[model samples]
Target: MKKADLEAYRQRLMLLRARLCGDVSALAKSALHGAAEQGGAASSMPIHMAELGSEAFEQEFNLSVMETEEDAISSIDAALRRIEEETFGTCTGCEGTIPKMRLNAIPYAPMCVRCAEQEEAH
Candidate 1:
């Protein structure tokens, strides 16, 4: 890719990172509020079946969101470091050139599709 394209991807990565961080933070705050309103760890046992279901759903949803946000943050950080080291868009596992189209779709990707699928398979 051209230098300009790399810079553009960098900007996109930064924006994605910022957004993910904000989302994770917000989810964490919401979880904390919910936990607090339940009156501490001693009161974790829901008084009613409905209350249990709601809390379980919210906790599971927040956990999923947090996991996704964490992955995004890690990917963005790795991409930024690669950009600095002049290796952005290169597959970390196989050192292959990542297609520009893929990079455009996922600016923080650290591996090409083939390498990524292979890695996941193992």
Candidate 2:
């Protein structure tokens, strides 16, 4: 990849990493604390059993989203490393040049579409 393009992607990935880090922190706080953190809606005594269930579900959902965001952050980190190594747009699987359209859509993609599909199939 060109030096200028690599720098641009690096900047974008850094911004994404920063944003996702904040998201993960927020999700962790909300998931771990639940209603207690949200304006003291929680009490020493539990509310309704159904509300407890809902809180559990919400915590689980937040944790799930955090995991997804964490994975994306990892990918962004790997992409930044690849950029530093001068292999940003190259497919790690097939060693082909990944298309610009694909890169534009997913700047942190490690492989081309075909390789990605194959990887997913396995």
Candidate 3:
């Protein structure tokens, strides 16, 4: 890959990381607020059943998104490492040059299309 293109991807990754971090912070804050309300001395858990259920649902959704964001963040970091090592465009599974289009589509992809398909099939 060209140096310019790699730099562009790195910038994009940084942006994505920032956005994910913001989402994680917001989610954590919201979860804490829910807990605080429930754990309050004057609060009655049984009377707040509906509110608790909604909070639980929101927390579950946020946790799921946080997990996905973490994975993407890790992959982006790995891609940056590969760029530093001059192996950014090579497939880890098959030692093949990953297609340029695939790299453009998914900047963090670590495998070529063929190897990715094979893995998915299995």
Candidate 4:
């Protein structure tokens, strides 16, 4: 990759990392506050079976979202490391240059389209 392209990817990756970090922090705080409120309300009031089921479902959904966000953060961190190592935009799976379009779409992607599809096929 050219120096300019690498620098651009670095900047984009940094911005993405910052945004993901902020989002994860906010979601964590919100989840904690929500759980606390729900717990207090449940203790003070006679909650019906349906309400309990719904709250449980909501908590599960939030947990899933947090897990997904955490995975993204991990990917972003790895991509940042790749940039530092001067391997950004190179597919780890195939040792090929990942297309610019794919990089533009997913700056944290570790593999090219072909390798990603093959991995998914397994």
TM-score of each: 0.88, 0.90, 0.84, 0.88
Model 2 bad stretches (over 4 Å): 35-44
The pairs that clash in candidate 2 are none
List the RMSD of every prediction in angstroms. Answer: 2.7, 2.6, 2.1, 1.8
Q: Which of the two, 1 or 3, has more lDDT?
A: 1
CA deviation > 4 Å runs, candidate 4: 41-46
Where does model 1 exceed 4 Å of error?
Answer: 40-47
Model 3: per-residue Cα lDDT over 12-84, one tens digit each: 7778778878887887788777678768767445466787688789878877887888888889889889988
Candidate 4 local lDDT, 1-122, one digit each (tens): 89898889889988987887888787788778777877685464436988777767876787788789889989988998998899988999999999999999999999999999999999
Encode model 2's per-residue lDDT on 1-122: one tens digit a residue: 78888888889889989999999999988776765654464455456888767777888899899999999999999999999899999999999999989998999999999999999999
Q: Which ten residues in a row have the lowest lDDT in candidate 4?
A: 38-47
As a TM-score, model 4 comes out at 0.88
Task: Tell me the lDDT of model 2 at 109.
Answer: 98
**Candidate 3: where are CA atoms >4 Å away?**
41-48
User: Any residue pairs clashing in model 3, and if so which?
Assistant: none
Error of 3 at 63 (Å): 1.1
